[model samples]
Target: MELRLTLSLTAALLLPGLAIAADAHADTAPAASRQAELPAWEQLSAEQRELLISPLRDRWNAQPQERARMLEHAKRWKALPPEARERARKGVHRFEQMDPEQRRIARAIFAATRDMSPEQREQFRKDWARMSPAQRQEWLRKHPAPEGGRGR
Candidate 1:
């Protein structure tokens, strides 16, 4: 079943001309008639647009590589089971709730993790999984920010 879904997704991505044709027809309708189209993201309340679709829209409009990657991510998301999709949506919401400094720290951690070898990463993950709440707090306390401060 997974293989069949994977094949379907692969075919859809590889033959995007068909998708473009379908979207072209959809786009031909009068702009003012499109009720579902969102206004500028900044105009909406944060709760109303949790994930900030504006960044995705800007990337889609300006960067072909980023647009392609986003499309691929969307396809993969669509292929996920409903439960997995819900979990992913929750994760995205959590990410959106993070402050800019927290987000930057998370991104840096991710980049550092990505640079690690698979075996090292697995060991790190295992060690992290084993850490108790107290131990985690202690580790953070020991790793205090530099003289200026965390953001600095």
Candidate 2:
């Protein structure tokens, strides 16, 4: 009788742990299924293909380093959440719409602000918000594009 009671107690303790493990496993099932369903290269649409291989003809040979970098970027991009991916796509679209001069100015501003502390960045935002459009234009004029051009 004592042996049976001990066995019963052991079962009771293990049952909750088994249940918790099963719940954790169930939560990951959807992500596992998603990973399983990764599309083949041929299955991609033309637009998707263009996005994957834009501005690169003969990517296999002409720019091997760039192609490798792009491949790494693609892997990281695929790991992003849906909302983050959407926001990035929108940003790219907005950047594409800018003229060369505007692009240069925006890039310069972004580079200048990239490493700023949170407080410093907030102060900059406040100062920018206080600027008139003409003042903003003048600021861009003062900080012309870096010499020797920008790439990457």
Candidate 3:
């Protein structure tokens, strides 16, 4: 569930460049450059489109119970305003930039308080920031991270 929350948070900006980069024989450039220059959906071939959507498809198949929630998330993402979508894309990019440990803490915190109001989340973050390392660890221990939300 935690993993689902973290992933759903980014569904608005979930362009699978990996699908493009996976074309080993065709893409002559280095993998990094290929990923950097991902083609638009219409530009890609049928295979590329399949590869792009495969992860989401596989995840959907694997988690039957979460299908309704996941579908709702996609609908909500589509319903967001253009400016709001851009902000979400930027937020995902910022989240991607954090170090591994920071990412772990972020995912954990996000999973813990995703249902809170904005003001409440801000207050929670302030309280979290005030905790000592040991206290933070204790807090984490008490509210352990879910299996797949470990910043993998």
Cα lDDT tens digits for candidate 3, 47-93: 87776677788878998986886687677777888887776676566
Give all candidate RMSDs, comma-separated.
14.0, 21.5, 6.2
User: How many backbone clashes can be found in candidate 2?
Assistant: 0
| Residue 67 lDDT (model 2) | 66
Q: List candidate 3 stretches off by more than 4 Å.
A: 1-40, 90-100, 150-152
lDDT of 3: 0.62
Q: Report, for every candidate in turn, its global Cα lDDT versus the true structure.
A: 0.47, 0.52, 0.62
Where does model 2 exceed 4 Å of error?
1-60, 64-72, 117-119, 133-138, 147-152
The local lDDT score (0 to 100) that residue 32 gets in candidate 2 is 73
Determine the C-alpha RMSD for candidate 3 after optimal superposition of all C-alphas: 6.2
TM values, all candidates: 0.40, 0.49, 0.60
lDDT of 1 by residue, 11-56 (tens): 2332222222223335555657653675666786774454444445
**What TM-score does model 3 achieve against the real structure?**
0.60
Cα displacement (Å) at residue 96, model 3: 4.6
